[model samples]
Target: MFAALAWSLHAADAELRRALVPTSRYTPSELREGLCAALLARSSARRRRVVLEVTLIAGVNDELQHAHQLADFIAPIERACFDPRRKSGRTGVLINLIPYNPTYNRLAEGETVESRNDMSTLGIPHYSFFERPSWERIDAFQDALRARGVWVSVRASRGDADASACGQLATNRKLAAT
Candidate 1:
């Protein structure tokens, strides 16, 4: 099982999270608390491995400072999930860094983009305002995490050209319909 934490709660603005994920009922703090509780609950023997995914969006939450915040936020959870008794000495926590995949606007034909709900009203720009970080930036982010001893990996970009990559499933369907 895996928990996709999208962005570091410590580094991201709470209002931005709510605006981006309007359907989610839990606030950032509540989500973090719940994740910790769930991790602790499963920390005992026969604990399951949980990979945390963080999609790095350029200019959004892909800075070096954000990496530090992410490391700090994950430290306690890593400890809670670590099992020394286990022969592998694994923490059972893996962080997967995914580069953002651009998606087309879901507007029907002839619909003006301006007709969509204004995300700026929530004090944050729309999701389209962000873009994928450069490859060098991604490497630097990974290096920062490794420097902090976090088990991290950058997910390779695949199937994006065919709209089958992460975050592209729905877009694939939309394209097919058109």
Candidate 2:
């Protein structure tokens, strides 16, 4: 389960998400509530663990407040997984925090191309404001989640040297093709 903007159900949150990830067609409510419900159902039925990956973008959704919202959002799902009434042993949700990698466009000119039409052709947007959170910030965010009893882990970046990081794949493909 990938939820880069999990707290984006409210009007302001949704606007922030739209600015960063305009290509996303699903509403924030659908992405948050609907996806959580589906994941909970699947985990209960299959008796398996679910891992939710959230990409942390600096000044976008990496604040401590967002961490609290995330904890609140996943609380019910986590409880459902560990409900004593359910015979499932240890099925639960784990959150993986992935710091945003500097993509090709970000590294190239330090500015995003604002043309939506151009971005549509490449199937990727150039997020000028997106940046990886500092180590201190990441740690604080992790601590906040842990304080709320939510299991969480910080993911290390891989393939970043080759522009194949999490949000860089599509842009890399387009550049390679060109």
Candidate 3:
């Protein structure tokens, strides 16, 4: 629904070609391996056109730095990030990341994220912002991505207004029988 709406609004001026399935269910390795395998299998990727990515509702926090660690497994990036906490050493790639945040509350009216962005060299875009970013901040993120010479975007949800808050999508399947 949101995707369709976004298209309705910007389809003429937009170049959103690919999509990443949004979820953190897969471990970073699982995500990376799957993405790499898909890329390897694609003729377009061999031609260096399509880029794989980590989708919305999927990312690693400081504690779960799967995305951070996954970097070492992938090839070298062109310029690497400066932040010590984030993964290190990558300079360039044909495509970079610009993933989305899904754990949003109504409180998310105006906020932004700032990443060191060396990770972007991998052809996977990490939203410079994290966690329920606001529309106001999206432009800065766009500007940052533009500075990197990469296109930018915010992943949108297509179904279910009540589709649980990203990581907050938790439910106990088994209920105590009364």
lDDT string for model 2 (11-126, tens) is 12545556555677875546656655665566443453456677887766788988888787666566545646545343366788888887735434453365422333333334
Going through the candidates in the order shown, the clash numbers are: 0, 0, 17
Candidate 2 regions exceeding 4 Å error are 1-13, 36-48, 83-91, 106-113, 116-126, 170-178
TM per candidate comes to 0.75, 0.67, 0.31
lDDT of 1 by residue, 45-128 (tens): 337455667888777678898788778777767776677776866676677898988775456779654677657675444564
Give the per-residue Cα lDDT of candidate 1 at 65: 84
Evaluated with TM-score, which candidate comes out highest? 1
* Rank list by TM-score: 1, 2, 3
The per-model lDDT (C-alpha) reads 0.70, 0.64, 0.33
RMSD (CA, Å), each prediction: 4.1, 6.5, 15.4
Rank the models by lDDT, top first: 1, 2, 3
